[model samples]
Target: MVRSILSSSTENVLEKALGASALRHKIISNNIANVNTPEFKRSSVLFEERLAEALNETKATPARTNPRHLAGHNGGGDFNPVIVTETTTSIRADGNNVDIDAEMASLAKNNIYYNAVAKELSRYFSNLKAAINEGRR
Candidate 1:
């Protein structure tokens, strides 16, 4: 029962989202820190698209010919965020692509997303705790 709760898709997705957002926050902070460095390119984290793809892929039923076949793992199991560097254009004369305004906006957005995910996770745990305690009362 505990394993099932930990492996639930909702919990897994929320955990992944929280992790991705935290990583994104660090990447955005790094980009801002290197904004003045010469030839520095802004780095961004890519996870939502890949997460969506994983989720969609898991929705499909896989053919199993043998009982020993492994179950498909999706969503949080193998989800990894890709860090892509901006190389196409430079917004500054120093060849740095980091835009302070954009980075600030991204930081704000990421923070909001992180907080939302955390709140959801907290609620999930709270519900679980309540369920566990209900038998005592």
Candidate 2:
């Protein structure tokens, strides 16, 4: 059914990744903007490790109470990204942790990651659309 397909693990993972990437982009941009501000701490989004752990969680097979019961999928739920500020170290005398060079590099990396996830989501939806249209033709 449409609901099942929309809630598929692949779709959920891609959606979460896109959202996390966007958040990371914003955080990185903020760091860049605060590069000259004193006592500004750089923040980063934590997602990949948590996502991997969620995906690798063990699934318990549900006990079937009826002969006609539908099988349940053990696909993990959507993951939320955590944003943490780096407060342990400061590379400058002003106690600011934002490094322009590092922020720029992170920005570029996040952009690439976002683009890749977006492209994959586009491809997924395109395939779904093609399937829907196939019966019409």
Candidate 3:
């Protein structure tokens, strides 16, 4: 189906990663913003590990030619990023767990990841458009 083609596995993966990166950006910013707040704990996103698990599962999973076929643990599309807040430990006397320097570094890294994923998706669409244009020629 056209919908299935448009939402291919690769595109789904990239989209999920992009979404995670965006969430990571917000989470890192929040951590930075709450660095001075007493008893405030830092939060982080958990996506990559779940993504990896799904990817690895896909390798051993048998292809299902029928829609009714039993599925395996390769449900990559179902894994969503989780926001986990640290409940213990602190870097200062205020019981605040946020580390300014670490949060800054995470912000930069997530920015780069988001940009790269966005660019890749843009490129994918561009190539698809080119193919469609060429098909008309």
Q: Which stretches of candidate 1 lie over 4 Å from their true place?
A: 1-5, 62-76
Every model's TM-score? 0.83, 0.83, 0.89
lDDT of 2 by residue, 1-137 (tens): 86976566788889999999999999999999999999999999999987876776525546578989987655466468999999999999999988899889999999999999999999999998898899699
- Per residue, candidate 1 scores C-alpha lDDT tens digits across 46-111 of 999888788777777476679899866543357778899889989889899999999999999999
Which pairs, if any, clash in model 1? none
Question: Candidate 2: how many backbone clashes?
Answer: 0
TM-score of predicted structure 1: 0.83
- How well is each residue in 25-65 modelled by candidate 3, as lDDT tens digits? 88998899988999999999999998987777777888889
lDDT at 96, model 2: 96
The per-model lDDT (C-alpha) reads: 0.87, 0.87, 0.87
| Model 2 quality (TM-score) | 0.83
Among these predictions, the greatest TM-score belongs to 3
